[model samples]
Target chain A: MSHEPRDNPAQHREQREPEELHTPIGWPLLVVFLGIIAWGAFYYFHDLLSATGATSEAGDRRSVVVVDPTAKADGAAVYAGNCAACHQATGMGLPGAFPPLAGSEWVLASKDIPIQILLHGMSGPITVKGSLYAGVMPAFAQLEDAEIAAVLTHVRKSWGNAAAEITADDIASGRKAFADKSTPWSEAELKDKVGAP
Target chain B: MSLSIAFLLAMTFLISVGGLALLVWALANDQFGMGQQAAETIFAPGEVGEVEDPATPSAARAVMQNARKAAHQASDSEELFERTIADQSSRMPVLFWLSSSMVWLLLGSVFGVIASIKLHLPDWLVQEAVLTFGRIRPAHLNVVAYGWASMAGVGVGLWLIPRLFKTALVGGHYAIAGGLIWNAGLIFGTAAILAGLSDGLEWLEFPWQTDIALVIGGALAAVPLILTLIKKRVGHLYVSAWYLIAALVWFPMLFVTANIPNLFVGVDQAMLNWWFAHNVLGLWMTPLGLAAAYYFIPKIIGKPIRSYGLSLIGFWALALFYSQVGLHHLIGGPVPTWAVTISIVHSVMMVIPVIAVAVNHHMTMLGSFRLMLYSPTLRFVVLGAMMYTFASVQGSMEALRSVNTITHFTHYTVAHAHMGLYGFLSFVLFGSVYFILPRLLDWEWPHAWAISLHFWLVFVGWGIYFWPLTLGGWLQGLAMLDPARSFMESVS
Candidate 1:
């Protein structure tokens, strides 16, 4: 059958007789396929070996350092992990629940106040910047003295509150003093023991 | 902070000014002067051993001269036809790339189906960690994006660029090598991801070890087209060629820039990730798809595009605007407000190019509507073009803060994404395959019924896939906004 000639010159030129070229599955493709297979095998085995190696290394390392838990705590890191959720990253804590540590009289007063709070926990209505916040601050008693000191130091120094650094020795003393207190302390009890802000 | 801001502003200013200067230099140098002659070169009569015209002094003499000229023209046509046939036949590399893409498409579909099913029945494939939903979802995305879309796009470019340049493809071996290496990379990358070795970045999940293969593969694949462009017979760069070349250039840069590990940290890393992710759609897939649509729509209909000026506007505007628009993905996130605002502004500016392309395509298809019923190529191409306009405009709207407030973290974004990737890009690729395969293989498709059935099934399926998700997402957003609505209620 004869086809009609196209009006456009480019279209007319494009209407060419069909010709097929025989392109067999060549050697390059085969070589590449083999190469891929080899690479995949290597990658899979390497990943498995490395994963096992890491776990074994971790296991070997853990046994030696099981009892020594005096690792230096990064103040910023401790605050981000433990304190940021309720007090907030800016230290402008949630209204009517968690009190803001930023420029709070209690935070700036003394290192012993925060050290006691970290080791023993705190509860009841606490007035900060004229707003009363009543919430339970869980005792991070499981944390090492160094971590407790670091977090207390972080909160005091942060959010425009200028205060003295809290040391691990101070945290140790605070924990020793609060050893018999099983329950969280009220605002009045904390103030009475640590001195009024 | 102020100093850094000033430095950034200066850098932006310098880049813009430098780009403008280069454009001006090109314009003044007459680089684009031979438009009409270049456009006609592809169709000009082939050489017939330099046949000389005899001076016609009488009627008989004129008739004899005319007859001789006709004989020469006919032989020239025959020679041109043979050359074209040889050109079409020499595309084995493209076929290789396309065939590999098909395999990936099937693989991706399997992953997608499994992932979708797991959403409802999580325990179905819970035995193996590799077959988990988290692994399967990324694998599906990677297979579709890199394996199917990218490979198929390269295949089309390899064929289309040479045709536009009116030259035989130069580096067939390079393209084949690239395709093979690319497939190897995909195999390794997907395996790694399934084995829980993912880098944990969306769209950039391929482990660094395997990603290097993709970079090398992409560079190799791009060589042939770059060679074709350098050796082009015509002076005028067609709009399709502009898009094709830009895409080839943009992709490697985007890929390399995004994959540089430890170069950015924290919020900066998120910014770069979104930048790379969005541009993969905008700069890479969108350009290739649009280029195919632009070339096929006019070529099939036997007409030039409606407006050359509009095509240029669309191409340049897209290049300029689309780059900055990716930051809109991080709206309301930790990134600077100025960056997000700039992205939103650029996203809206995208409408300029979208409309330009829309008008050009719309006017071209205005008188050729009847062809869609008869031509499968036209049917898919036209529909894809329309969807491109729709999806891009919807994307611009979604980038707006008002609309984004509702659409963020909702299934509406997912629906929008499918509309762009599947409805626009994939549909265009399907049309391109249908149009190109016959020419490349020198054989007509075996079944018209099958083609029609495939089209309907996908078309209806896509409609079903997109609409409910879009509506449900909007409802979900509204429910989320209302304090009275519970999370469970909204989810249900």
Candidate 2:
């Protein structure tokens, strides 16, 4: 096979190093070139504006808003999002800082006392499960009545604590009762109002 | 901020003026005067369209040359040249570098297979800390990238530059020394990695001390190539020479800058790491692969490239676009939005050079498709050329924000990377090695069937390796994107 090129001189001319012809680039290539450039330039500016937060909700353009008109507020999810960081997912609060919500008389004792505490918040050293916890619990007054009620109800039933479910009506009444109290409440003040739980 | 703006303006002015000055100088010197005649410079007297192989008798070639000389006197200075002098000079260093690279290639593949197995069976190699998946994976990456791929690229360049320049390699001894030094560095680096003494960077796992060794070795290797280019007998520089020179220039700068200790931190480090990593492919491996493709494809088929002008555009555009496209890997990361956006844009713009290259190779090989059956070099090289187009286009797609949002941080990205590096770069390297070794060793392949066997094994193995993984990775990306799925479910 290798000898055939040599056997016939006209069959195979001597091979040379690769060369390039002077052919012109066609129109399809030109179209692709122009199209990519235009698209790239447009995408850069458009996505850059949104990515830099130049518009509302532009940080994540894929964040779709799902407005569920008939949806119920999930208390477990609310707990995970808001309270689980300090209280823990197991409802077991930190040893000395955060008070435990599970199997605690403060949460299961009286529904109104817990509601008042949630609405006004508490700062002074409070007793939970016979231990003193001095950390402050922030006011959840911003949460809807149903959200607050649902969260309290969730805490009551979890972690071996059996208690009646709190209703939105109960939370609404608690809000009305504490409407004038603008500041966080002391433990003593709460105990006095609730008749020493 | 205002000072930076003024500096940038000054730079812009300087570049424009410099470019204009170069154009004027080029025109005055009649740089483009060679015209169509310049393309013929690669061929020696009576060299075009002739079948010259290592196995072919020199007496026959001399006879053919005399016949051609008698028929037409194209140039008065044209004379019969002996390629034996250059081939003999290149024999030692090229063989040494290529053989060492093959050793590393085997070792790297072993490490890669181990890592892949560990992904499926965690307990398979857990007895030794050195063999742990974390250590094994980086070792695989670094060994293949720095040892196998880089060494092979340099080896090819060392042999090719001399061939293209039509000169004996001036400092072949230095290249041999460089190969030894390079292997020593790889040994230390891979050992250090297994022993948990890594730098903790992705592509830069080797410690700074080892990096210095690599830099020195690379410089030593580059000396012969530069000397050969300087001592070139040919007046016209081929397209392959251009790409090889650019690769040699770009790689050291990237390696040195990226390895500087404590220069970058946090997001800047990430950007630098990716920039260096991606350029290792784009500037280093891609150029080497393309150079081989440009040379071997036409050399095998006995034809010139389709478009000279398109080749120029391809080379310059690749330099312009590939340098900036690295930052696209950090899209949606904490880096500045504008920085990533610019990278994405450059990545998309890569289509210009890619298309230019694609057209040049495709159209050159258009009528010569049948030659692939007779030439094993053509088969692998053509596949490599095709994959270069496919991988680069897919890379452009992957850089888009819409595509990246799903594919980023997924196995899909891994598959794409393999497509570029192994599919495109490694295949080209394989083809080049096959073509080069025979010439260097002065031996024809003992069996044609063995070559076919090797080609099919690699080709079929690659298909089995790539397709299922690509499909699985895409599905994995989709599963991961959905918030409704649990982690276990997504992975499973």
Least well predicted 10-residue stretch by lDDT in candidate 1 chain B: B49-58
Query: Which portions of model 2 miss their true places by more than 4 Å?
Result: A1-14, A48-197, B1-31, B49-80
Return the number of clashes found in candidate 1: 0
User: TM-score of model 1's chain A, to 2 decimals?
Assistant: 0.65
lDDT of 1 by residue, A110-185 (tens): 7778777777788878888998887889989899888888888888888787799988898788878768889887
User: Model 2, range A6-76, lDDT digits (tens) per residue?
Assistant: 12222223255677786665767767766776776577556654545343322554557897866767789
TM-score of 2: 0.74
* Model-by-model DockQ, in order: 0.02, 0.25
Looking at candidate 2 chain A, the ten consecutive residues that score lowest on lDDT are A1-10
The TM-score leader among the candidates is: 2
In candidate 2, position B108 carries an lDDT of: 98
Candidate 1: Cα lDDT at A97: 77
Q: Is the docking of candidate 2 incorrect, acceptable, medium or high quality?
A: acceptable
How close is each model in CA RMSD to the real structure?
A: 19.2, 9.1
